[model samples]
Target: MGGWFRENILDAGKLPTLLALASFVLTFLITRTVTRLIRAGRGPFRNITPGGMHIHHVVPGVVLMVVGGFGAVGSGRYGVAASVCAVVFGIGAGLVLDEFALIVHIHDVYWSEEGRQSVEVVILATALASLVLSGFSPLGVDTLSPDEREDRVTVVATLVVNFLLVLITLAKGKLRMALIGVLVPFVAVFGAVRLARPGSLWARRFYRGRHRARARAALRSYRHDRRWDRPRRRLQDLIGGAPDRAD
Candidate 1:
């Protein structure tokens, strides 16, 4: 375990990234717990307001992100200062993304169904960070041998193929799969070959005259959603607290 850490983490210069991700997850979890307590009227935690304006946590999050981002860039990659800055930035990111839906909608919907977007974004971010930490390079370049990496034609071909796969995946309306597929090419390949979502660009373009394909795709999507949605929501609620009844 120690050897693996040294080789995969320290030697790979991923310590700062690991620290940042850890801090981000911890800060988000803690923040959610406190806010949930406040919502339930079971804790000393309270909302912050000033001058008749309810101040959201995103405000401080943005400040910390800026400061830490600049500080880390100035301090360079490997050192105590950089690690500290990374942690600060992570905390800021957590706070900011916690209210991502509110930022998008420009309204207070922290406990609404739309607010679930924040949870989804956070999960996506965490997954991406974890993949990076695990040594998965974006665009699957890390899979190349040293000679293949040095070969311009090989590199270009690999990049072009990966890019097309990513585009196809996106057109299929598999946003998360497309993002992750940049790091793990096989994921993108699977998405690219799969049936597109009912309302996706790929479906509109290719399934226009194929009623059976479209019907199958829609049915599959419905079944998948039915199988996963409830469990996913329960997990989200367990972590971030349930949405308010008013929503």
Candidate 2:
């Protein structure tokens, strides 16, 4: 275990990143627990309200993000200082993402169904970080040989090709695929070659007046949702707690 950490983490100069990832996940989990407790009114935990105005966690998160971000910028990427900065940044990210739905909706809805968006965003963020930690470099740069990397034209070409593929995947309305594809180009290729979602820009531009294609795309989307929606919701509920029932 130590050997693996030395080789994969230390040698790769990813100790700070690893530390940050750990802190990020732990912070999110802890924050969720406290918030849930407060919501249930089953523990001593309670919301932070001053002068009858609720103060959300995102406030401190932004502060940490600023401090850690600037600290990281000044300290480079190594040593104890960098590690500390990474942890701080990770905590900030966790707090901010935990309230992502509030940010997007511009209102407080932490216990409502809309709040599940925060869970989804955090899951996506975690998955992206995990992929990076697992040795997937942006735009598949890690896939290139040393020789290819030395050749500027080859490196530029590879990056451009991968970027276009990711863009196409995004345009096709496969947001998750496009995001993952930024790390794994093959995933982007899969998304790029697939049919666009019914209301996606790609579909609207290309599938216009094509009734059959629209029907097929809609049907595929519906089937895909049917297959994954329940499992996805269950996983979200398990991790972030279920939404509150409306009176």
Candidate 3:
């Protein structure tokens, strides 16, 4: 079984590997661009001709592009392992960007309760429209460079997938959604590293450490909440004519 798997899977990683690499490059570039723009004191989409833009909209599209590309390119490289990694990365991407995802969902959550959904709705709509356009074609830019078309397509696909993922979470909130939020980016990189270096036990150890950090963060939050409760109760008692120490 090991021999057959090795012969078939390990040897068939070239295309998927390339796709995964492409995803990594695209994601890194997009993330960096957004970060740089934010740091430059320039609001996102400032240079657009007329319609304006939300720079944050790039993340989801990048995530989805990677997911689709990796899945298609590496479907056979590691059997079920590849599929699992893809799902993990896809869900993780969805979860990590749950904030942006929530921007759209807030409308659903407070459809009648709030009035400021207009701005969020507008930004999100623009992003979704951009995704649709880019996913189907490059749209406006000159066609001098093939790489430009590929980049545009990847960005659009990523946005669509991530946006769809947000829709799914809004429709179905559960443990599965939470898990995906935490795992997509992690699993994509994890799977890629693992594929690139099957013998690296250190990678596995590093993931374990990450889990431990999450556990610690939860504990800290719980403690902080408990501390707040005691103080609130004391303040309420004092307000009701009971003596309470200032310290």
Q: Candidate 1, residues 8-110: lDDT per residue as tens digits?
A: 8777778889999999999999999988888888978988887888999999999999998998889877889989999999999999999999999999889
lDDT of 2 by residue, 1-247 (tens): 9999999998888988888889989999999999988877888888889999999999999999888888878877778899999999999999999999999999998878999999998998899999999899999989999999999999899899999999999999999899999999999999999989989999999999999999999999999999999999999899999998899
> What is candidate 1's local distance difference test score?
0.92
Off by over 4 Å in 2: none
Q: What is the lDDT of candidate 3?
A: 0.40
For all candidates, what are the clash counts?
0, 0, 9
Model 3 over residues 175-197: C-alpha lDDT tens digits? 22323322243322233322111
lDDT score, residue 186, model 1? 99
Clashing pairs in 1: none
Q: For model 1, what is the alpha-carbon lDDT of residue 130? A: 97
RMSD to the true structure for each prediction, in A, is 1.5, 1.2, 21.1
For each candidate in turn, the TM-score is: 0.95, 0.96, 0.26
